[model samples]
Target chain A: MGHGPGYVEADEDMSNPLGLKAKLGLDVFKHDKEPHITIKAGMAGDQRLKKAIIVCPAGLYSENAQGEVELTIDGCLECGTCLLACGSEVLGWQYPNGGAGVQFRFG
Target chain B: MSQASTFDVIVVGAGLAGLAAAYTMAREGLEVLVLERGEYPGSKNVTGGRLYLNPIRDMFPDLWAKAPLERHIAHEEVCLLDTEGAVTVRYDGAELGTQPYQSYSILRAKFDKWLGKQAERQGAMIVTKSRVDEVLFENGAVVGMRAGGEELRTNVVIAADGVLSFIAEKAGLREPFKAHDFAVGLKEIIELPRETLEARFNLQGDEGVARLYMGDVTKGKFGGGFLYTNKESISLGIVAGIEALNEAPSTIAASQMLEEFKLRPEVARLIAGGETAEYSAHVIPEGGLHAFGKFFGSGILVAGDAAGFSMNIGVTVRGMEYALASGYLAAQAVIRAKQKEDYSAAALSEYERLLKESFVMKDFENFKDSLHALENPRLFTYYPRLAGDVMRDLYEIPAGPKARIFPTIRKYFSVGELWGMGRDMWRLMKI
Candidate 1:
């Protein structure tokens, strides 16, 4: 049988948003720290940030009840969609620490 | 010497382009350091499985014997999906998969790490998981980069930093990727029994196949789906235009789109009873030359996806080969510059000369018009329906008299529509 690190034994069922993170196999930071990507808190009312809430492919960006930016960095795919959605003024974009973000098991 | 002055070349991103450039430079006796953002080289990368060997073979002959390649692709399949049916055209040839094979399916996590190791074997320092935060410049020349709060200096900075290329942006080489120029690809690696996968794809040991789907697969958007056979799994995915998706007359989430695609009888047949091993999403540049920016600046050169080196010509979506080629050329230019001890834009212009002479520029410039033709709505929506209607007409027997072939074909695609398709074909395939 052809077997190696890239191959994984799979289970039936569509991977949901929560289950998707596990499949990504990202190595998490040991300590609670600031995320590499942050939505501009002061610019929460900015229209671009508002639109980024829906445009982000990972669905990691959202809006609070007050229609402000709410972003979750845990499952960020690092595709840079949010950066493109909201430029430097409203988004802080950087690669996650050496080895602590979205790691694709089969990319 | 200080830590910043240790290396001659410091490459950000340990993907294929970075590795290829490092390997070439290191082999030529230059001090090289490669910084990777992922836990490993390939962990942050993805592909549709076909890595054209021509460029790699040109760079490193006999690489296939040791590379972590899955299978040699010998069969090329094209399927067009419609509202209710599909039409497939298959090509099987004996001359394929011979020595110096054309292409193969590969898992990037293994193959890229292998490429990284190859470069490491040649004395390249590959620092995995270290993401370069910024490219430091001096007097309009790139001097080095800072990563993880540490600064490292080098004579040249090669930006093989994938599609987004924050490093390239730091050098002022690229603008923020716009949705119109980008396409988001979502894939599922579905594991299956080796024998089952072989049988399902109609292949013997080691032989593989690839299929590209047009039409309803993207829900009528300006993009397509692909299935590439790996050893124990199938790399199945869809690439849809992000801007098109954003403005789609009707739309659903990319996750929903993939789930719906998996339900299609045409797709469901291939992966029946299989399980999804992993799920992934990435964004690729599909705007041809329009997506490209300045590939070079003083003391810096951009390669791979970061340099906008990918091309999607309908029949094939190619990036890795272009990445390898650009990386190799960048190294050649770097080697030449090192001899002269000048890393200015004038010295780096040799890299552009090499690319212009190679398949990198020739192919993209040759196929530039297809980038426009691919956006034609008919190819994705109306034409696939036409194909389905034509297939249905040809297969189903009517109780009455049979119609002539020309009239039957014309009925599905009228004369004007045929002329329009002819123009699209002419524009896309003129090269």
Candidate 2:
């Protein structure tokens, strides 16, 4: 079963009308929209790094700290732990290309 | 008749669905071959790691005595969490701890691999690391499949290749899945000492609790998150609509959303010292009635995720059970088709009949409204926001005389401005 109305729409005032309401339109923001990232720490903006590294950290959808598993097990969290560990700036950590990543049945 | 070197039936994918099919076929004296793409049968597979025992027991009588089960859960808890507070419902019955009932937590890598071995003992040939490239057809009838560039012919091909089933698409049995048809599930298996797990969750030896967290898990973006207990590991995950995440703002990546969930004061308390053991993600088919297509066609039968048999609407993500059931039914259909010397789509249609006759299709038909109900946008959007809004006022504990409950209740209803709660209630009733 899903959250009872008692649980989901519990407090009316505690809710922030801004971020809370905007986040509701995830579908509108995701596919129809795209994200713009300004890379400052990685390789130079113009120069092409020879290695196209993918930083798949321990938490496939979350970042991890230093002492974590480095190998990819089909379900990497994209946590950026390895990216920070590698520090090579070669690892390009982003969500799975598309249609790939974690799924949830309820929120 | 073509004298193929292989066997009468070739079951592709040694996951639970495929293994169930192969085991059933072999028991009936049919030569069955299970080809797995993974290095081992379940090595590439992952699940929430809990198995409701009744279904498994129905398939294999007294299976609990022999199946490779991890632990039988004695307790279950459902916790509804917001950014600040949580409300929990717990069900603990000793009866749930015993016979013909109760669910066991499992690791697919171990469970599926063991089940494959069971099928082998029953005379099924399981070939691992053999990816089925395509299904072979002669005169527009499925005869076998291509594995690693080699053609292996058989009487029937059972497609149980999971959510992104390539074989189903290749055979023209199904269309490509849309974002609305599925959810992307991410999970982490965190390991805690055996004693710690029991103590943390307030459980005895094998008892466990499964918690479902809503609200901030996906940063209040539609889908929900879950945490289930195993013997010594906790399976934590977040699953959301693919389209929803694509729509979120750039400041919050999906990963950061999950981070926000774990970092929440309520959720963070649970996994305080646990070390992460494994992380995995798999596409879960959430499409209910609208997603189910033809169950069989052209000398082949589609089972499990390939047929969009997953039931993912709040209560449970139920493809594995349906997979095992549909796979067993498919095998029976193939056996009948072989006996009648007919592998036409009409003959394979029996599989569909059996599915409808079983809980697989029956439940889907019964709860068909769930798809539209969940997709209504109000559940995730308006509901969570309104809930957080009201609770903010109700929970303020004052040191002086307690504030009258009437004003807070009035405030709660007034701020939920859209449609009245009555409309949502009516919609749920109609669904």
Candidate 3:
């Protein structure tokens, strides 16, 4: 299902994950900001399940070579997808400081 | 304890709800303060971006003349897509384009900012870029809000904060919304030249179209997709209940679902030559009243998405109306509470009373079944495909005797599918 015509490849000129974000003017997102989420150390060690790596809407969580879940907090959409998907046992979710996170131009 | 730290009412979040509530209170001559976490109101929000005006007309009678409205939606459609083609149910009329219009598409940043300005003019203090870290309490009664390491007192605190509001949790009203209780949405505002947009969408000046897509968009998930036209831009996106999404046979990412929908020839044409303008994702409450939190407790009253006032009523998903309505009601309740000199849960109960007495509650009651029908995968998946197939067969123009419409539709529907739809129809009648 992933390979066939059932799947539509994003335009070649477009970047799958970010081309849209760039056009959305998210490049000016508050990148130099505080982290609103705390990923438990060795969360990947349990390896029981790391759904956050796959389920985050922003694709913010990815597995590192060391089997650690590396999170790119700067691009976090703050939609709380990962927060809800991660469960409290694995993550500490908090809103970004008053004005220190991704901002939507037309939201 | 200086006067500067006190207010008659304080609203958290400056989205439609907070602004409406603040404006209502301010208009009553109460000192209202609204703290928004965004750089400006709506900087952290996302919407399919359409505001149905009839519901909010009383709150802002001359909204059309003063609000930063994009366009009055005169054209609307529901596009059912199978793999290669689409079956569209289009509705258009001059009546829909008249004053006190059916609806208008909006950009939250612009609309919310305008709303905040309106509240300010009515004596409300709208503080953008200030987040309410938590709800402040005194002697087990909600009293004010703490933000940025500072505590400010208010006779009442209205949590107009969006969904996933920690303020709700801070008040012990409820925990963070679970994935099953809500759907995650991702949207992109594509910038298009007005002439090109008008030409492609067959729109005249200041006219717009809103489209809701089923099938193939969410890859047959419980939620669907939307395309709303804003004067020079188009908002398109998919919303899938995270529970259904996580349970799907495929691990389709949200962005992948949107990309596939954008690439569909049916959608591509409408957005051709348009530049991607904004990308955003938000969590919308899907579960109706069942998943909603308490309306008021002590001095804290939760409204908007924070209280789960939004709904996904089949094809016409609604939030802004409920948010604005609840905000208006909450403000009215706060005014009454101040008059009674009691912000207790009992005194603030008026908020829920106003809601129960308004369409906000009645509509939720009325559409409970429709929402039920929508949650059934068949509504978004099987039925659209079946409808699309029947529509396809009817119009294929093959050189043969024409097939009867009933049998043609039945040919695509199994006995079980028929039963399900029959039940859906019956339940819809009850609604």
List the TM-score for candidate 2's chain B.
0.93
Q: Which portions of model 3 miss their true places by more than 4 Å? A: A1-10, A13-27, A45-49, A65-68, B1-5, B397-410, B413-417, B423-431
Docking class of 2: incorrect
Which model, 1 or 2, shows the larger lDDT? 1
DockQ (Cα-based) per candidate?
Answer: 0.39, 0.04, 0.40
**Per-candidate TM-score against the hidden true structure:** 0.91, 0.78, 0.92
Rank list by DockQ: 3, 1, 2
Give a tens-digit lDDT track for model 1, residues B7-40. Answer: 9999888888999999999999999999997888
- Where does candidate 1 clash, by residue pair? A98-B129
Docking class of 1: acceptable
Local lDDT at A105 for model 1: 69
How does residue B5 of candidate 2 score in lDDT?
Answer: 49
Query: Candidate 2 vs candidate 3: which has greater lDDT?
Result: 3
Worst 10 residues of 3 chain B by lDDT: B1-10
**Candidate 1 C-alpha error for residue B80, in Å:** 0.2
Question: Candidate 3 on B66-165: residue-level lDDT in tens?
Answer: 8898888898899888776778999887789787688999999888888888889899998877878767788988888778878788888999888887
Q: lDDT rank, highest first? A: 1, 3, 2
